[model samples]
Target chain A: QQQVKQSPQSLIVQKGGISIINCAYENTAFDYFPWYQQFPGKGPALLIAIRPDVSEKKEGRFTISFNKSAKQFSLHIMDSQPGDSATYFCAAAKSGANSKLTFGKGITLSVRP
Target chain B: DAGITQSPRHKVTETGTPVTLRCHQTENHRYMYWYRQDPGHGLRLIHYSYGVKDTDKGEVSDGYSVSRSKTEDFLLTLESATSSQTSVYFCAISEGTGGHYGYTFGSGTRLTVV
Candidate 1:
Protein backbone atom coordinates (compact mmCIF):
# COMPACT_ATOMS: atom_id res chain seq x y z
CA GLN A 1 0.00 0.00 0.00
CA GLN A 2 1.20 3.49 -0.82
CA GLN A 3 1.21 5.39 2.43
CA VAL A 4 1.71 8.71 0.70
CA LYS A 5 -0.25 9.69 -2.38
CA GLN A 6 0.56 12.64 -4.63
CA SER A 7 -1.65 14.21 -7.25
CA PRO A 8 -1.01 15.59 -10.76
CA GLN A 9 1.72 13.32 -12.04
CA SER A 10 2.91 16.24 -14.13
CA LEU A 11 2.47 19.99 -14.02
CA ILE A 12 3.13 22.97 -16.29
CA VAL A 13 3.09 26.62 -15.35
CA GLN A 14 4.18 29.86 -16.96
CA LYS A 15 7.03 31.79 -15.50
CA GLY A 16 5.98 34.14 -12.73
CA GLY A 17 2.87 32.06 -12.11
CA ILE A 18 2.20 30.06 -8.99
CA SER A 19 2.56 26.28 -8.92
CA ILE A 20 0.83 24.00 -6.49
CA ILE A 21 1.31 20.28 -5.82
CA ASN A 22 -0.71 18.26 -3.38
CA CYS A 23 -0.04 15.10 -1.37
CA ALA A 24 -2.05 13.04 1.09
CA TYR A 25 -1.09 10.45 3.63
CA GLU A 26 -2.94 7.67 5.40
CA ASN A 27 -0.63 7.06 8.37
CA THR A 28 -1.31 9.29 11.33
CA ALA A 29 2.01 8.29 12.84
CA PHE A 30 3.82 10.42 10.30
CA ASP A 31 5.22 13.54 11.90
CA TYR A 32 7.84 14.82 9.49
CA PHE A 33 6.85 15.86 5.98
CA PRO A 34 9.53 16.80 3.46
CA TRP A 35 9.73 17.61 -0.25
CA TYR A 36 12.65 16.75 -2.48
CA GLN A 37 13.66 18.10 -5.87
CA GLN A 38 15.59 16.16 -8.47
CA PHE A 39 17.17 17.24 -11.71
CA PRO A 40 17.93 14.98 -14.63
CA GLY A 41 20.77 12.54 -13.90
CA LYS A 42 21.21 13.81 -10.36
CA GLY A 43 20.17 12.82 -6.88
CA PRO A 44 17.14 14.24 -5.13
CA ALA A 45 17.81 17.19 -2.84
CA LEU A 46 15.81 18.41 0.11
CA LEU A 47 13.87 21.50 -0.86
CA ILE A 48 11.67 22.13 2.12
CA ALA A 49 10.32 20.33 5.14
CA ILE A 50 7.69 20.89 7.81
CA ARG A 51 6.68 19.33 11.07
CA PRO A 52 3.10 18.56 12.06
CA ASP A 53 3.10 21.21 14.74
CA VAL A 54 2.75 24.02 12.21
CA SER A 55 -0.02 24.56 9.71
CA GLU A 56 2.26 26.46 7.35
CA LYS A 57 5.95 27.07 6.78
CA LYS A 58 7.48 29.36 4.22
CA GLU A 59 11.01 29.81 2.97
CA GLY A 60 11.64 32.49 0.41
CA ARG A 61 9.31 31.68 -2.48
CA PHE A 62 8.55 28.11 -1.43
CA THR A 63 5.84 27.29 1.06
CA ILE A 64 4.41 24.13 2.58
CA SER A 65 0.88 24.11 3.93
CA PHE A 66 0.12 21.12 6.11
CA ASN A 67 -3.14 19.92 7.66
CA LYS A 68 -2.71 17.35 10.38
CA SER A 69 -6.41 16.58 10.89
CA ALA A 70 -7.05 16.24 7.17
CA LYS A 71 -3.86 14.21 6.67
CA GLN A 72 -2.97 16.36 3.71
CA PHE A 73 -0.20 18.76 2.69
CA SER A 74 0.58 20.91 -0.31
CA LEU A 75 3.61 22.66 -1.78
CA HIS A 76 3.20 26.08 -3.35
CA ILE A 77 5.92 27.78 -5.36
CA MET A 78 5.52 31.48 -5.93
CA ASP A 79 6.77 33.04 -9.19
CA SER A 80 7.63 29.79 -10.83
CA GLN A 81 10.79 29.87 -12.86
CA PRO A 82 12.30 27.61 -15.48
CA GLY A 83 14.92 26.62 -12.95
CA ASP A 84 12.17 25.14 -10.83
CA SER A 85 11.35 22.58 -13.52
CA ALA A 86 12.21 19.21 -12.10
CA THR A 87 10.80 16.18 -10.37
CA TYR A 88 9.34 16.69 -6.89
CA PHE A 89 8.75 13.98 -4.32
CA CYS A 90 6.71 14.15 -1.14
CA ALA A 91 7.75 11.98 1.77
CA ALA A 92 6.54 11.29 5.30
CA ALA A 93 8.13 9.59 8.28
CA LYS A 94 7.52 9.05 11.96
CA SER A 95 9.91 10.67 14.38
CA GLY A 96 12.26 8.16 15.96
CA ALA A 97 15.72 6.71 15.83
CA ASN A 98 15.01 4.14 13.13
CA SER A 99 12.11 5.65 11.21
CA LYS A 100 12.22 5.32 7.44
CA LEU A 101 10.53 7.69 5.05
CA THR A 102 7.80 6.65 2.64
CA PHE A 103 7.80 8.55 -0.63
CA GLY A 104 5.13 9.32 -3.20
CA LYS A 105 5.40 8.40 -6.87
CA GLY A 106 6.65 11.93 -7.61
CA ILE A 107 5.54 14.73 -9.92
CA THR A 108 7.33 16.35 -12.86
CA LEU A 109 6.94 20.10 -13.03
CA SER A 110 7.76 22.27 -16.03
CA VAL A 111 7.89 26.02 -16.10
CA ARG A 112 7.41 27.67 -19.49
CA PRO A 113 9.56 30.72 -19.82
CA ASP B 1 27.27 17.94 -1.80
CA ALA B 2 27.75 16.39 1.62
CA GLY B 3 30.88 14.58 0.46
CA ILE B 4 28.93 11.57 -0.73
CA THR B 5 30.12 9.68 -3.80
CA GLN B 6 28.78 6.66 -5.64
CA SER B 7 31.15 4.71 -7.82
CA PRO B 8 30.48 3.30 -11.28
CA ARG B 9 27.92 5.96 -12.20
CA HIS B 10 26.77 3.69 -15.03
CA LYS B 11 27.08 -0.04 -15.45
CA VAL B 12 25.69 -2.71 -17.74
CA THR B 13 25.86 -6.26 -16.48
CA GLU B 14 24.68 -9.63 -17.65
CA THR B 15 21.99 -11.64 -15.96
CA GLY B 16 22.99 -14.16 -13.29
CA THR B 17 26.18 -12.20 -12.63
CA PRO B 18 27.02 -10.67 -9.32
CA VAL B 19 27.44 -6.92 -8.97
CA THR B 20 28.37 -4.61 -6.18
CA LEU B 21 27.94 -0.86 -5.78
CA ARG B 22 29.89 1.30 -3.41
CA CYS B 23 28.92 4.38 -1.43
CA HIS B 24 31.61 6.45 0.28
CA GLN B 25 31.07 9.41 2.51
CA THR B 26 33.54 11.77 4.03
CA GLU B 27 30.95 13.23 6.33
CA ASN B 28 31.13 10.15 8.56
CA HIS B 29 27.43 10.21 9.12
CA ARG B 30 25.85 7.67 11.42
CA TYR B 31 23.08 6.53 9.09
CA MET B 32 23.48 5.23 5.53
CA TYR B 33 20.64 4.09 3.31
CA TRP B 34 20.39 2.44 -0.08
CA TYR B 35 17.40 3.21 -2.28
CA ARG B 36 16.33 2.18 -5.75
CA GLN B 37 14.47 4.46 -8.14
CA ASP B 38 12.38 3.31 -11.07
CA PRO B 39 10.05 5.00 -13.51
CA GLY B 40 6.79 4.34 -11.71
CA HIS B 41 8.25 3.90 -8.25
CA GLY B 42 9.84 7.02 -6.94
CA LEU B 43 12.32 5.66 -4.41
CA ARG B 44 12.22 2.38 -2.50
CA LEU B 45 14.63 1.59 0.26
CA ILE B 46 16.52 -1.65 -0.17
CA HIS B 47 18.70 -1.61 2.93
CA TYR B 48 20.10 0.67 5.58
CA SER B 49 22.79 0.80 8.23
CA TYR B 50 22.76 2.76 11.43
CA GLY B 51 26.28 1.91 12.55
CA VAL B 52 29.28 -0.17 11.73
CA LYS B 53 28.50 -3.89 11.26
CA ASP B 54 24.79 -3.16 11.62
CA THR B 55 22.31 -3.40 8.78
CA ASP B 56 18.63 -3.91 8.18
CA LYS B 57 16.35 -4.57 5.21
CA GLY B 58 13.99 -1.98 3.95
CA GLU B 59 10.81 -2.04 1.84
CA VAL B 60 12.46 -3.87 -1.07
CA SER B 61 15.35 -6.13 -0.12
CA ASP B 62 14.58 -9.45 -1.72
CA GLY B 63 17.50 -9.65 -4.20
CA TYR B 64 19.82 -7.22 -2.49
CA SER B 65 22.27 -7.32 0.38
CA VAL B 66 24.26 -4.61 2.12
CA SER B 67 27.28 -4.25 4.39
CA ARG B 68 28.89 -1.50 6.38
CA SER B 69 32.36 -2.44 7.55
CA LYS B 70 33.33 1.10 8.50
CA THR B 71 31.70 4.39 9.06
CA GLU B 72 32.76 5.92 5.74
CA ASP B 73 31.71 3.08 3.46
CA PHE B 74 28.51 1.23 2.66
CA LEU B 75 28.39 -1.55 0.13
CA LEU B 76 25.37 -2.92 -1.72
CA THR B 77 25.63 -6.25 -3.44
CA LEU B 78 23.31 -8.03 -5.82
CA GLU B 79 23.44 -11.73 -5.25
CA SER B 80 22.46 -12.34 -8.85
CA ALA B 81 21.58 -9.69 -11.36
CA THR B 82 18.11 -9.85 -12.90
CA SER B 83 16.40 -7.89 -15.64
CA SER B 84 13.85 -6.63 -13.16
CA GLN B 85 16.63 -5.11 -11.06
CA THR B 86 17.61 -2.61 -13.71
CA SER B 87 17.16 0.74 -12.04
CA VAL B 88 18.97 3.69 -10.53
CA TYR B 89 20.41 3.23 -7.07
CA PHE B 90 20.98 6.03 -4.61
CA CYS B 91 22.92 6.28 -1.36
CA ALA B 92 21.95 8.71 1.33
CA ILE B 93 23.59 9.80 4.56
CA SER B 94 22.15 11.41 7.63
CA GLU B 95 23.96 12.91 10.57
CA GLY B 96 21.19 12.17 13.02
CA THR B 97 18.89 9.23 13.39
CA GLY B 98 15.66 8.96 11.36
CA GLY B 99 16.87 11.75 9.10
CA HIS B 100 14.87 14.42 10.86
CA TYR B 101 17.57 16.86 9.78
CA GLY B 102 17.29 15.71 6.15
CA TYR B 103 19.62 13.47 4.12
CA THR B 104 22.44 14.04 1.71
CA PHE B 105 22.22 11.88 -1.39
CA GLY B 106 24.88 10.76 -3.83
CA SER B 107 24.59 11.31 -7.54
CA GLY B 108 23.28 7.77 -8.22
CA THR B 109 24.32 4.65 -10.10
CA ARG B 110 22.40 3.58 -13.17
CA LEU B 111 22.51 -0.21 -13.35
CA THR B 112 21.25 -2.00 -16.42
CA VAL B 113 20.93 -5.76 -16.49
CA VAL B 114 20.88 -7.63 -19.74
Candidate 2:
Protein backbone atom coordinates (compact mmCIF):
# COMPACT_ATOMS: atom_id res chain seq x y z
CA GLN A 1 0.00 0.00 0.00
CA GLN A 2 1.22 3.51 -0.76
CA GLN A 3 1.32 5.18 2.62
CA VAL A 4 1.79 8.63 1.12
CA LYS A 5 0.00 10.17 -1.87
CA GLN A 6 1.29 13.25 -3.75
CA SER A 7 -0.79 15.31 -6.12
CA PRO A 8 -0.06 17.04 -9.44
CA GLN A 9 1.95 14.48 -11.35
CA SER A 10 3.65 17.51 -12.89
CA LEU A 11 3.57 21.28 -12.37
CA ILE A 12 4.59 24.43 -14.26
CA VAL A 13 5.16 27.85 -12.74
CA GLN A 14 6.49 31.22 -13.84
CA LYS A 15 9.77 32.47 -12.49
CA GLY A 16 9.44 34.27 -9.14
CA GLY A 17 5.97 32.78 -8.74
CA ILE A 18 4.92 30.53 -5.91
CA SER A 19 5.02 26.79 -6.46
CA ILE A 20 3.10 24.37 -4.32
CA ILE A 21 2.85 20.58 -4.13
CA ASN A 22 0.61 18.63 -1.78
CA CYS A 23 0.78 15.18 -0.20
CA ALA A 24 -1.30 13.02 2.14
CA TYR A 25 -0.61 9.94 4.20
CA GLU A 26 -2.68 7.07 5.61
CA ASN A 27 -0.44 5.76 8.37
CA THR A 28 -0.80 7.76 11.57
CA ALA A 29 2.16 5.88 12.99
CA PHE A 30 4.42 7.84 10.65
CA ASP A 31 5.73 10.92 12.44
CA TYR A 32 8.54 12.12 10.19
CA PHE A 33 7.90 13.72 6.82
CA PRO A 34 10.60 14.84 4.43
CA TRP A 35 10.76 16.14 0.88
CA TYR A 36 13.41 15.16 -1.63
CA GLN A 37 14.54 16.94 -4.78
CA GLN A 38 15.96 14.99 -7.72
CA PHE A 39 17.43 16.01 -11.03
CA PRO A 40 17.96 13.97 -14.15
CA GLY A 41 20.83 11.45 -13.87
CA LYS A 42 21.30 12.17 -10.17
CA GLY A 43 20.13 10.89 -6.83
CA PRO A 44 17.29 12.46 -4.91
CA ALA A 45 18.59 14.85 -2.27
CA LEU A 46 16.84 15.92 0.89
CA LEU A 47 15.15 19.25 0.34
CA ILE A 48 13.19 19.91 3.52
CA ALA A 49 11.39 18.02 6.26
CA ILE A 50 8.79 18.54 8.97
CA ARG A 51 7.75 16.69 12.08
CA PRO A 52 4.22 16.20 13.37
CA ASP A 53 4.90 18.41 16.33
CA VAL A 54 5.05 21.63 14.31
CA SER A 55 2.40 22.84 11.91
CA GLU A 56 4.80 24.67 9.66
CA LYS A 57 8.53 24.98 8.97
CA LYS A 58 10.45 27.12 6.55
CA GLU A 59 13.98 27.04 5.15
CA GLY A 60 15.06 29.93 3.02
CA ARG A 61 12.73 30.00 0.00
CA PHE A 62 11.19 26.61 0.78
CA THR A 63 8.42 26.04 3.28
CA ILE A 64 6.63 22.98 4.60
CA SER A 65 3.07 23.28 5.90
CA PHE A 66 1.90 20.28 7.85
CA ASN A 67 -1.48 19.40 9.39
CA LYS A 68 -1.74 16.53 11.77
CA SER A 69 -5.51 16.41 11.85
CA ALA A 70 -5.82 16.14 8.09
CA LYS A 71 -2.77 13.89 7.76
CA GLN A 72 -1.40 16.06 4.99
CA PHE A 73 1.76 18.05 4.24
CA SER A 74 2.80 20.37 1.47
CA LEU A 75 5.91 22.06 0.06
CA HIS A 76 5.70 25.66 -0.95
CA ILE A 77 8.42 27.45 -2.90
CA MET A 78 8.40 31.20 -2.80
CA ASP A 79 9.81 32.89 -5.90
CA SER A 80 10.25 29.61 -7.71
CA GLN A 81 13.11 29.55 -10.18
CA PRO A 82 14.10 27.41 -13.13
CA GLY A 83 16.88 25.90 -11.09
CA ASP A 84 14.21 24.54 -8.79
CA SER A 85 12.77 22.43 -11.60
CA ALA A 86 12.99 18.77 -10.69
CA THR A 87 11.09 15.84 -9.27
CA TYR A 88 9.91 16.35 -5.69
CA PHE A 89 9.12 13.42 -3.46
CA CYS A 90 7.20 13.47 -0.19
CA ALA A 91 7.91 10.65 2.19
CA ALA A 92 6.77 9.48 5.60
CA ALA A 93 8.78 7.52 8.14
CA LYS A 94 7.31 4.60 10.02
CA SER A 95 7.81 5.35 13.67
CA GLY A 96 10.18 3.04 15.53
CA ALA A 97 13.82 1.99 15.75
CA ASN A 98 13.79 0.36 12.32
CA SER A 99 12.37 3.40 10.60
CA LYS A 100 11.30 2.70 7.03
CA LEU A 101 10.41 5.44 4.57
CA THR A 102 7.28 5.24 2.47
CA PHE A 103 7.35 7.54 -0.55
CA GLY A 104 4.85 8.97 -2.98
CA LYS A 105 4.92 8.62 -6.77
CA GLY A 106 6.70 12.01 -7.01
CA ILE A 107 5.86 15.36 -8.63
CA THR A 108 7.88 16.88 -11.43
CA LEU A 109 8.06 20.66 -11.00
CA SER A 110 9.02 23.10 -13.74
CA VAL A 111 9.73 26.78 -13.28
CA ARG A 112 9.69 28.82 -16.47
CA PRO A 113 11.84 31.90 -16.67
CA ASP B 1 27.83 14.92 3.94
CA ALA B 2 27.38 11.19 4.30
CA GLY B 3 29.86 9.23 2.20
CA ILE B 4 27.81 6.72 0.25
CA THR B 5 28.65 5.01 -3.06
CA GLN B 6 27.29 2.27 -5.31
CA SER B 7 29.44 0.13 -7.61
CA PRO B 8 28.87 -0.71 -11.28
CA ARG B 9 27.02 2.56 -11.88
CA HIS B 10 25.76 1.09 -15.14
CA LYS B 11 25.38 -2.49 -16.25
CA VAL B 12 23.88 -4.53 -19.09
CA THR B 13 23.38 -8.28 -19.02
CA GLU B 14 21.35 -11.04 -20.62
CA THR B 15 18.32 -12.69 -19.09
CA GLY B 16 18.89 -15.56 -16.64
CA THR B 17 22.22 -14.06 -15.64
CA PRO B 18 23.15 -13.33 -12.07
CA VAL B 19 23.56 -9.73 -10.94
CA THR B 20 24.74 -8.25 -7.69
CA LEU B 21 24.78 -4.58 -6.66
CA ARG B 22 26.98 -3.21 -3.91
CA CYS B 23 26.45 -0.30 -1.48
CA HIS B 24 29.31 1.06 0.59
CA GLN B 25 29.19 3.79 3.21
CA THR B 26 32.14 5.58 4.72
CA GLU B 27 30.23 7.26 7.53
CA ASN B 28 29.50 3.90 9.17
CA HIS B 29 25.81 4.71 9.55
CA ARG B 30 23.76 2.08 11.33
CA TYR B 31 21.17 1.72 8.55
CA MET B 32 21.36 0.88 4.83
CA TYR B 33 18.64 0.38 2.22
CA TRP B 34 18.18 -0.85 -1.36
CA TYR B 35 15.42 0.54 -3.55
CA ARG B 36 14.45 0.53 -7.21
CA GLN B 37 12.98 3.46 -9.12
CA ASP B 38 10.47 3.05 -11.89
CA PRO B 39 8.06 5.38 -13.62
CA GLY B 40 4.76 5.83 -11.74
CA HIS B 41 5.94 3.36 -9.09
CA GLY B 42 7.96 5.75 -7.00
CA LEU B 43 10.79 4.12 -5.05
CA ARG B 44 10.19 0.58 -3.91
CA LEU B 45 12.35 -0.86 -1.19
CA ILE B 46 13.93 -4.25 -1.86
CA HIS B 47 15.68 -4.75 1.44
CA TYR B 48 17.44 -3.01 4.29
CA SER B 49 20.10 -3.66 6.91
CA TYR B 50 20.00 -2.26 10.40
CA GLY B 51 23.49 -3.49 11.28
CA VAL B 52 26.14 -5.94 10.25
CA LYS B 53 24.61 -9.36 9.57
CA ASP B 54 21.12 -8.06 10.34
CA THR B 55 18.86 -7.58 7.34
CA ASP B 56 15.17 -7.46 6.53
CA LYS B 57 13.11 -7.58 3.35
CA GLY B 58 11.04 -4.64 2.25
CA GLU B 59 8.00 -4.09 0.03
CA VAL B 60 9.51 -5.37 -3.19
CA SER B 61 11.85 -8.14 -2.08
CA ASP B 62 10.88 -10.74 -4.65
CA GLY B 63 13.58 -11.98 -7.08
CA TYR B 64 16.18 -10.41 -4.79
CA SER B 65 18.30 -11.33 -1.78
CA VAL B 66 20.58 -9.26 0.42
CA SER B 67 23.66 -9.74 2.57
CA ARG B 68 25.41 -7.48 5.01
CA SER B 69 28.78 -8.89 5.98
CA LYS B 70 30.18 -5.60 7.28
CA THR B 71 28.72 -2.50 8.79
CA GLU B 72 29.87 -0.45 5.83
CA ASP B 73 28.77 -2.78 3.05
CA PHE B 74 25.47 -4.21 1.80
CA LEU B 75 24.84 -6.34 -1.24
CA LEU B 76 21.73 -7.17 -3.27
CA THR B 77 21.85 -10.21 -5.52
CA LEU B 78 19.43 -11.23 -8.21
CA GLU B 79 19.80 -14.93 -8.93
CA SER B 80 18.24 -14.65 -12.37
CA ALA B 81 18.12 -11.35 -14.11
CA THR B 82 14.91 -10.48 -15.91
CA SER B 83 13.66 -7.66 -18.05
CA SER B 84 11.20 -6.73 -15.36
CA GLN B 85 14.04 -6.11 -12.93
CA THR B 86 15.71 -3.59 -15.22
CA SER B 87 15.62 -0.22 -13.51
CA VAL B 88 17.72 2.29 -11.62
CA TYR B 89 18.74 1.05 -8.17
CA PHE B 90 19.66 3.36 -5.32
CA CYS B 91 21.34 2.84 -1.96
CA ALA B 92 20.59 5.05 1.00
CA ILE B 93 21.75 5.58 4.57
CA SER B 94 19.60 6.83 7.43
CA GLU B 95 21.54 9.56 9.24
CA GLY B 96 20.19 10.68 12.57
CA THR B 97 21.31 12.60 15.65
CA GLY B 98 19.49 10.49 18.23
CA GLY B 99 16.09 11.55 16.87
CA HIS B 100 14.07 11.58 13.62
CA TYR B 101 16.10 11.77 10.38
CA GLY B 102 16.05 11.44 6.62
CA TYR B 103 18.05 9.45 4.09
CA THR B 104 21.04 10.25 1.91
CA PHE B 105 21.10 8.45 -1.42
CA GLY B 106 23.90 7.35 -3.69
CA SER B 107 24.17 8.27 -7.39
CA GLY B 108 22.31 5.06 -8.32
CA THR B 109 23.04 2.19 -10.70
CA ARG B 110 21.24 1.69 -14.00
CA LEU B 111 20.88 -2.01 -14.87
CA THR B 112 19.53 -3.40 -18.11
CA VAL B 113 18.59 -6.99 -18.87
CA VAL B 114 18.41 -7.99 -22.48
- Clashing pairs in model 2, backbone N/Cα/C closer than 3 A: none
Task: List, residue by residue over B1-114, the lDDT tens digit for candidate 1.
Answer: 559999889999999999999999999789999999999889999999999998999999999999999999999999999999999999999888664878889999999999
Best by DockQ: 1
The alpha-carbon deviation from the true structure for residue A40 of candidate 1, after best TM-score superposition, in angstroms, is: 0.5
Which residue pairs in model 1 clash with each other? none
What's each prediction's TM-score? 0.98, 0.96
The stretch of ten residues in a row with the least summed lDDT in candidate 2 chain A is: A93-102
Give the runs in model 2 whose Cα sits over 4 Å from its true position. B96-99
Would you list the C-alpha lDDT of every candidate in the order shown?
0.94, 0.91
In Å, residue A47's CA in model 1 sits off its true spot by 0.5
Worst 10 residues of 1 chain A by lDDT: A93-102
C-alpha positional error of residue B68 in candidate 1 after TM-score superposition, expressed in Å: 0.4
